[model samples]
Target: MPPMADIIAPQAAAALLAELVRCPSVTPLAGPAGQGPYGEGRYAALLGDRLAALGASVEFREVEPGRPNLIARFDGPAGSPSVMFEAHSDTVAVDGMTVDPFAAEVRDGRLYGRGACDTKAAMAAMLLAVQSVLAADGGLRATVYVVSTCGEEITGLGAKALVGDGFFAGGRVDAAIVGEPTDLDIIHASKGSGRFHIETRGKAAHSSAPADGVNAIYQMAHIVAAIERDVAAALAAMADPVLGSPTVSVGTIRGGSQVNIVPDACTIDVDTRLIPGQTFQTMAALIHGVLDRSRAARGDLQYVIHNRPAYPAFFIDGDAPLPVLVARACREVLGRSTLRAAPWASNAGIFAEAGVPSVLVGPGSIAQAHTCDEFVEIDQVVQAAKLYAAIIRAYGGAGAPATGARGE
Candidate 1:
């Protein structure tokens, strides 16, 4: 094995990204069999093969029957902690992109494709970095695990399943690094988010006889107005120094069966973003309290929260060892210090909540994520690979055991 600094190169990262982008692993939607642009099973298999070729022990963890996750581990010396590098394999739908989402085209220093920037680039860079680390005699003191997961754009089912399966059992891992498009920044915190459905009930009657029945639509309208006011006030009163404040918005609403009849039922879908220290139960209680107070004022209106959790938010302290290691690695390899907070949500929150000290680090810009012309700069890809190698070298050095290493 060669030294870590001499084993990685820019071209290697580009090649990996190109191969991944060509797979067209878009988010799955209900559609004809094998007709959607997502479902990254093929790509996962390809990556598994690559990991095996690099001497890593690979396992295909199936979260769903058709959707699989790839977990590959490179063994190091004994007694060191294991570090896990995590990334989502599935991408958001390329519904309105102007470019061919699967082309993997490179134009003007940017690689244009569906998952190129959102995350595939990070996966590629991480893989290449692992290869470089192996080439170097730096031998890991702890094992390094690379996980490509499913359902990041939707329910985070892959991550949830991994947690439920005891993947983090025995406390082998000291840290985790979630490869999101952070432009090489280290994200120590992220806002939590959840979706809710509010339903109001009332008696229906002919529109011509207003006094004969209750109007559920009117009841819902009042509740919606109250939510807007109450939620806005809550946000205004509390703001985090890093993740800002919690927010709520009504995303959808439906009511009424006919124009001439008074509607007896109405539903509103709300999206809520929570800062650290908040939870679904607490938010639900607050919303219910608002509704209860409003109903008391109205005398005849009632509502209930129906939506379940879409996802949860997580936040780690900025000064945690994981962030410290990641920032130091970035500065040493990329010549720049990294930021420590992300405004949006990602799977890192899940890992953090599960007791894994995880930091978000990767190539590309978040602005390009889920956008039409999604792309990652070639330079960022190369730099990320080098940074990953440096992290491995710093933690796993030659003859170091794989027992207590963190994956930040």
Candidate 2:
């Protein structure tokens, strides 16, 4: 490996981030890949080479056929604590972007492009952290795994599969840090999300003879009303003090083949944000209860609800050793102590479900993510690299591990 000062510098990290932005690695369809843009193989290969150059063992852990999570491992001495740093590789589509999505333009100390803020910056920081450790004695007292996951903008398929595959040789990873757009603050908790569809069915008939057929649209209207009136109240009452209230919104509605016919089916897609105490089953029951009440009011209605996968909410004790180390690093770099909860879902939730203590801390603002003109401060990106490097040094650097090593 080259000297850490050469490979892990802020300019080097920024260059890596710029190259990642140029990849246009948008979410691929979740199946067998065609000659299309679904494969993250290109990005994974690029990262693999860099990890290998730094004397790390790199592997492409395939979640799907073409979407592989890049797992780069730098081994430390046996019995030393290990830490995993996670970042996602996929970005949302660039259908309506104001700037060229793949241009990777840098202006006034901000990098503008897709994935610049939502996460590729964090990827660069984690990579530099690993390189910095290797530059100092070729390894740390504790091992480190830098994983770049795929399909985070979609379903978090890579993270789910990575955790299922048994992280860090199926052994304990003392702590994990997920790089998300948290403005460089430590995120102790984030809300989860659930999506599902509800459908109502009825007989189709000529609109001219309105009384001849029951209206599924009318039934759906009653159902929607019930959900808005009752289920919402239930969610509001079940709020968590830290994360605030759980909430639901009906995003889309579709029905009726044509205006002349009475619709046989009406369907609505719903999105719900959950707090720690709320489970998918619990939320499902609440919706079902409301539906039943609507059904009883109109005996001629038939309805079906299908739930998509759910992301459970997660929280870590703020005073835990991992958070303390991360907070100290942030303070050292930024000269301020900042901590908060995120309203969006992150892989941290997935790791927490697996019994690994995880927190989210990274370079940009969540506000700029997925926007038409997305961008991240170049200074933040560089600072994030330094902060990550410091964290690795504080916990896994030189002769003996720190007092907070292994969350002691």
Per-residue CA lDDT of model 2 for 1-408, tens digit only, reads 667677666578668889888876778754333234456777788888978987888999888777899988888888777888888988876778999888889888888998899888888888877777677666687778888998887767888888888863355676788998888999887788888799999889999987888788988898888888998998988877789999989999998898999998999998888888677778888888888887888787799999886677878778777888888888897887687888888888887777777889998999999999998987788788878887887767443222232110
Q: Give a tens-digit lDDT track for model 1, residues 1-408.
A: 655554455556667788999987776775421465658688888889988988889999887766888899888777766788889999888888988898888887789899999899888888888887677654565689999888888778788888889998878666788898998988877788888898988889999996898899999999999989986687668787777888988999999999999999999998888887777776777777888899899898877778577556777766666666777888898788866777688888787777788778999999999998889998898888888877877666443223322222
Output the TM-score of candidate 2.
0.92
For candidate 2, the 10 contiguous residues with the lowest summed lDDT are 399-408
Model 1 accuracy (lDDT, Cα):
0.80
Clashing pairs in 2: none
C-alpha displacement of 282 in model 1, angstroms? 1.2
Clash totals, every prediction: 22, 0
How far does residue 363 in candidate 1 sit from its true spot (Å)?
0.4
